[model samples]
Target chain A: MSVLYSCSHLDSPHSPLPPTYPSSSSSYHQLDKLYFCEECDAVRCDQCVAVEIASYFCPNCLFDVPSANVRADKNRCARSCFSCPTCESSLSIQASDVPTESGQPGPPYSLICSGCRWSSKEVGWSFEKPTGIALQLQKMNHQTEIVQSEFDSLKEHLESYISLSTPAPSAPSSIRSTRDPSRQISHLTQMAQKALHRDVGGMVAYSARSKGRSTGKEGEKEKYGWDELGVYEAKGSWRAGGESVLDGVDILRDLEDSGAGGMAEVGKRWGKSWDNSKMTKDVLPQRIPLQTKLTKRCPHPNCRHLLIQPDTKSIRMKIKMVAANYLPLVEIGRRRRRIPSNDMNEASEQPTTEELERRRRERRRTRGGIPIKEEDESMGLPLKRGETYLFQLALTNPLYDPIQIRLTQPHAAKDVNTWCNVSIPTQHFTINALKDAWAYDEEEEEGNDDFLIGGSEAGFSEEGTTTTGGGSGMGTLGKKSRLSILGGQGTKKGRDRETGVEKRSNTSKVILLVEVLPDNNTGDRVRFDLEVRYTYKSDEMATPTEPGEGSGNGEKRGKKEEYKNFTFWIRIDLGVVE
Target chain B: MGAFDPIATYEKGTYIETDTGNKVSRKATITGATNIILGGKSIIQTGSILRGDLRRSTAGQHVVITMGRYCLIGEGAIVRPPGKMYKGSFTFYPLRISDFVQIGPNSIIEAASIGSGVEIGKNCIIGKFVIIKDLAVILPDTVLPEGTVVPSMSVWSGNPGKLVDTLPETYQEAMEAKCKSYYQRFRAT
Candidate 1:
């Protein structure tokens, strides 16, 4: 079972969020990817955290580009690292095969894509030296110079009205750049302004008169006429080479002549060189776009603690407040489907795969968004309706000291139409403390293997094997198996080990029996939430003063020890009934 | 289906377990054992090839393949030192593979250095001098070009392998867990 923990941001920690809201799945994430804020005592996901770039580096060259140079280089590599325009793979520099008169080897070098064997010679770009190709391209590329000047002129033209005008009310709308990217050199200032979330100096500005915009008559213009600020007269050079329409016609004709093979994909047209490279031949090798290491902070305005601060030189994180260290790693696996008995429900008959598919299609028509894992049995097969299946809900305690876990099913949302019968047989269990890797190996030799493979027969504390009932008596009761510090090794294996429970190292695997109820409709969703509150001794807390807030079934601890209670919710989607 | 269901099982004499916990399959093609260094708990699976004979030309007993702990060379994978022409002579470079590196089945790796937690998926052709940094994933059937530099956290895929995505920050922990579990599961039964 693929599990996702709920990050109930709005809900109070005391109140468990009822799994009713549509798109609640969006708030769920894998425990490992989630962050923990110590102050808030809540889980923080990627969506909730604030992100800032830690460092910029070239993916191709692996060069750590300084932040200053990132802006100057337009967030792309300034070095000789370029990706092939055709295949989008990094290019390698190759020297000219034909030697000069002196036969002194390399002088004229060209970038070539080893994947596609596409050479820079296609674009007639041959550099004298191989080292600094981007620098050389800056001097040689006259087209970009013209484009940059044009962008500057357009920005300068718009800056006039913006300087003289009042503040605009509707400022959140993206400021559209003047250039279409059909030409070279996209306006970097607009991009930079957008990145910084700064208000762009623009033409449309609200005045005192426009503040009372409701007073204006329908289909009538304002007296100031801010809409028609100025006419952009085309520059002389642009007007002189105003053959763009004819050029488009020529490109269309070329497309007709060469077919679809001549065209470039939309993804290839953007990135380093944001150009109208419709044709494969028009695409030029661009400097590889830079990648950034992000520094994430807790999004809470008050508690802006560093969640992740990646080091510039190393892959290590300077400050990582990951939830994995603080919370129990919950994994639902070991799915065992019960064999359908003849006397029970065989007379009622089961729905075939085709019937289920058709009903699923009908359900899809009504609700098109909720994604269900269909047909891919790599992770798990679909849970069949009217059949009882056994699952192991394994909780791995990350703490050095052993943890007591209490599992309870949260009351389902109002809709009982699409629900299942979930029976968590063993409500409470204790996982052994996480020790060094070698400690487990030594412990195994000492014969602590009975707990690793649980016994399904009867409860035996001395054997370290508790809980007897399996799927036969799924929801027998809320049985609390108090497994005290498992002392000196018990050598014997579980006499008759079954599928109900298993434990290894710091992980405790308990049986979770789920009976998929038909509830009239088969294709609708049947998911349930499990409330897991783990109590672990807090090493840093002052013990004598703090009362370990008596949660239900509180086990008395040593006077010097303090217990910390943490509660989290997990939603398990028992796949559609077959 | 489950951890209880062993990920892999073999005959009693299928693998020869080294003192450092390195398990080398008897069927694996290993050359010049003296030049090869397998860090503790590594597994060289059946039919996999490790070329330790292809050491540096100027060396006297040079270590060729220096693999770190919990490394898995999958079935049919070939790992050899990267070779280059230097000063009118062809010489080999030592292949350094760090901890928790899982080279999947049928992958041919001629990379110079593979950092810790790097996983190369099945049928990948990792070309010569490819410097894969920590926590990078080379997806299955990927063909990385020669001298390609794969930085940390990036996932490379497709024929001409490009940075398709990135790994989560907790990938190192996950990789370590996976490697350890796989090592535990792989045993002589």
Candidate 2:
């Protein structure tokens, strides 16, 4: 037999070869025959496969693209394998013709390295279209700008024409009248004569008639009586000299004549007889009867007298007369007996001639004597030039009433001169003086004595000049009188040591003692204690100068500084005085 | 002898065996001689070569080696004892295997063990004493160094045979179990 030669390496020659097989076929046939590139790891067939294509580089190397391009393409590189559109790199094609489902041929494609499998499709090659709605919006915006400019120009033209037009002279008057018709009518009448030359009488009469008609609508409705219209027409005809018609005159005349005659007669009698005393006596008797008689005649059986009497019968006339006469006589006798003639004199023991003389002397002494030194010091008494001493008289008395003090100075003068008037209240004295009088002059002595005497120049009397033996008389008054004097004087010198001492040691103590006592003004009535502060300045001090110095030379220049010289307050209880 | 037995004639150094107990020797150089076992109905394509002491290995019955499977083996893809030694220290390196594994014509595998359901790509260099776990994928033209261990279900590529990624767990498991079931079925037969 012929040896079979096989491609199998086990035997070189054989009578019958097993088969002729290729050397590579053994391994290739056993494998799946799929080619896998480890670099790209993409499978490809032999025919369509390409190597090292630049645009086919995979995603891993694409990140190396320059930042500008990265932003332009939204961080994606273009499709260049050798030079990554994103990050440039040398290209290596890992795949050839990858078979399609139809088995059609195609160019080889590449894949990225295993790190990132980004494909060529992810790069900047994709196309997109702008939306239709965005284009329409741009057109609308352009149209709005044109319309706005046209409106602005129209407004400006209207404003310029308004300013340049001439204003009508009568425009204000017309507008004013339009607001109020009544005012317009009156104003038109005034202006028509001056400006329009219109008739005033016709317009005024028309306006008055219109006003009357308008007001008549609001008047109360009146019912017409026959006599009222008749009298009015009759009077009108009479006043017009009887030629005018009087349609109802006869009836009015008869009614007036009848009523007037009766009223006149009654008025005549009343006027003649109605004296106040007589009328009162006639209308009001001594006593009125309790009941009135209802029947015309006396309702007694067999009574001949048919006179009517009061319903209530009277008591006995003799008894009434006796009681009336005796009651009055007894009252007279009692009054006569109660009368004490010189009994009052004897019971009270009329003062003897010597006692009377002594009392009179005491009165005289109190009235004229100089106040004691201690009293003067305690009362803060100061000397009044003509009056000799400080004294208080009753505010209502005819003689020696306390006077109000007044100070006067010019608006330009700093120092004021004071005067006192006995007629006004003492409290108003200073206030009055400050309001009147001009600058005082040393050379003008005409009113000086009158002022010093505490008398109004208009009412000055010689009796106010009575001498009281110097200042000692100011001290001898009673405690109340002393207090009044001190209170007045202390008001002027409240800041001085002597006055303050006298106030603290004496006045306050006296006030306290008086306050503790029962008030007699209203004999224990409810009252409020009122305390008031009063301040005043004393007389200017007279400073002596050197023998050769002139009086005018000592006068100070510039404005004098005003000082609060004294301040004092008084407390008094006011209510019903007890 | 049965008609189903492979009619292979071995030369001086070649060793051959069939599914039905016929044996043949040939002139090819075979190292580390040991027993050859063939399953009941399995077929080995022609032009396939293998060199290793495979006394500890097995082939399932009814296993088919196709024509492309044969060419892959001839291109130095390895199946049984799928690794070899270069400098001879008993350390093994794996060969490249693709979607399907095969024994190439005139190729040697000096490694200690081979994984089941492994796919060895064509034109591979396998080193000595390497352990290849079950269902591993070896890409074409990959060379594994000696003493390397290819883990189970891994897809390996590159010259040094580093792992690319693991095969899907279910796929790997099914393939491995199918190999075992075939082995069991053949043994039962």
Candidate 3:
């Protein structure tokens, strides 16, 4: 029988395609390989199989089986077939079992159908059986049961053992006995050592012993002999290698070897050396009055010792020098001399009243000096105006100081009749120079003052002329005004752009007062008021531009200009004399 | 036939409506046995089989019936009884069901929860009583061991079903926020 197979180059194995068969009149074609039915062990192609197949089959049975046969097989009775011993299902014999030809036994098994209760025993066929999975499963189940029982028993035994082994009440006692005794002994020893070191007097003795050991024998010997080494000597002079009583001494000595050598010997012979004629005064021990009497007792009255000894003359000179240099006794002596004594008080009983008054006067003269008049006034300089001065005035002073001026009129004078009032309006400019425009003209050879009002040519007669003085014709006035107007126009045109513009109002004011000095320099001061109006003008002309634009273009022009026509006017008011 | 027997015999191209309103087409051989319940509104595709009693059980409202729910008999999945019994008295039948679960297409859930909010990747096997909790994610071809309990909000994958990580509770919210931010970042254009 021929089985159909379509061989296409479609890469995937899962692609769907129609099976082909071998026929002259149809599209079917034949394939070379044969396929077998698992139930019957019959090999055939796609055209030969008559029964329908359900389980996975060879390609031949897939195409040849009818749909009705497959359905019938699905519904077939399971009891009609013998059952397989291994799987408990009917089977179809695919091949016969081989005979046991060798000494070794062959497999003794039969094929069964996995679907229905069909077995190969109906076809009288058998095959060798290898180890069956069913037998292995039974063995595993038995083993699992045995292991489970053993595990259960083991768990029970462990639980009982744990319960029986719980600790009793003697555990702490046992632990204490096991501890080592040597450790405790060491701890006690350390505590005792610490206690001993903490006793205060014992600690002091220990420290003293340590100090003594550190210092050793050399320090002790030095401490014992220090007093002898400190002593000084006074004795006879000595030649080199000759015995001298003043050996190892710090004392006054002379260069000559006069048998009386040191400071003490020289002092003793001082009287003997003087000539009898020079010492004609009596040789009696001179009674020297006390240079400094003890006035009050020493400040430290509780000190039992007297500050100066009663026999001051008997003190050895060397001892006195040592006492003065090293002891505080000298300071005590000085203090006693400064304070007044309670006994033998001279001030209370000796001096008479006149004598006491005279002594007081002498002390006053020495402490306070005589007074002088001019010196007192010279100390204070009087306040002066215009020259800045610092003034100090009392309320009763004749002239009130400027600082006492009232807030409302700080510059007003205090005395009304004696005060000078000068009306000095702020001067805005100073008058420097003036020039006459027609100075070179021959017809105008007169001085520039001739053009001023009230000059000699003021009333000159002419044909159409009215009086040229105060009551002039308005026509001449108009003509003269035109000349001024023309002059102003020319000036405006000549001025720089910065200067040509008029100034805005509200300029600041600064007062300038001109005082005319009196002829005798003491007469009343005459004052003149000059109102000088100042306007700043620049020499450089401004560049023209659009209305809103700034002076950036003019600044770019490379020219530097100074101040140009600064006009000043002098207006005088004869106001006051000071 | 007994109540445990297969109620409907399925053939290729034949459509059968399950108790859960799902339309299933048989693509391979199958035997229906005892105690099976199929969920509603699901589909069973080609090369898949269902066997065993599912009538007494409960299927969630939106379950998918591509394969079983508890234990997936996998692709090329075979649902058959044990090969042999100890004695002639023993009769065997394997139980297959799609319980409370949402299975992706081509997944074989044999005996597992397939759980609420669970997303199974294509072609996965689930063993018996494996309670995959809510919102669990199973990657493709993952095999779950028997009696394993997957905690809630987790991802389980790999052959032995190791836990990957617990899913974030605000995972959806974060995703939405990221989308909104992305839109806002480019919205100026």
Identify the leading candidate in terms of TM-score. 1
Model 3, B21-127: lDDT tens digits are: 45545554454423334444444444665554332233533222233332222224433222122222333323323333335446655544444445566777666
Error of 1 at B87 (Å): 3.8
Misplaced by over 4 Å in model 1 are A14-21, A100-104, A160-230, A236-253, A271-277, A340-379, A413-415, A444-501, A519-526, A542-560, B1-7
Tens-place lDDT per residue, model 3, A1-578, is: 11122211111111112111112112222222222221121122223322222222111011222335434333322111222322222223333345456634356565544333345454444543433323333344343355456557666666554343322456776456336464334334333433564322344334543564589857633432222222222222224323345632212233233233222333233433321211111111111111111111112223222222212221111111111111000000000011223331344443443544553354334323432111111111221121111111101101111011110111212122221222222112121111222322221222112221111222222112221222112234453443333223222211211112111011011222221222212333221111111222223355332111121222432354422211111112221332
lDDT of 1 at A409: 77
For candidate 1, the TM-score of chain A alone versus the native chain A is 0.73
In the range B2-81, model 2's lDDT, one tens digit per residue, is 10111232243333444442222333333333423333223233344444344322343221121211112332223444
- What ordering of candidates by DockQ runs from best to worst? 1, 3, 2
Candidate number achieving the greatest lDDT relative to the actual structure: 1
* Candidate 3 positional error at A46, Å: 64
Give residue A480's lDDT in candidate 1 (0 to 100). Answer: 27
* TM of each candidate vs. truth: 0.79, 0.18, 0.18
lDDT of 2 by residue, A408-428 (tens): 211211122111111111222
RMSD per candidate (Å) reads: 10.2, 68.7, 62.5
lDDT of 2 at A281: 10
Best of the two (1, 2) by lDDT? 1
Give the CA lDDT, 0 to 100, for residue A277 in model 1.
45
Q: All models: lDDT?
A: 0.72, 0.29, 0.30
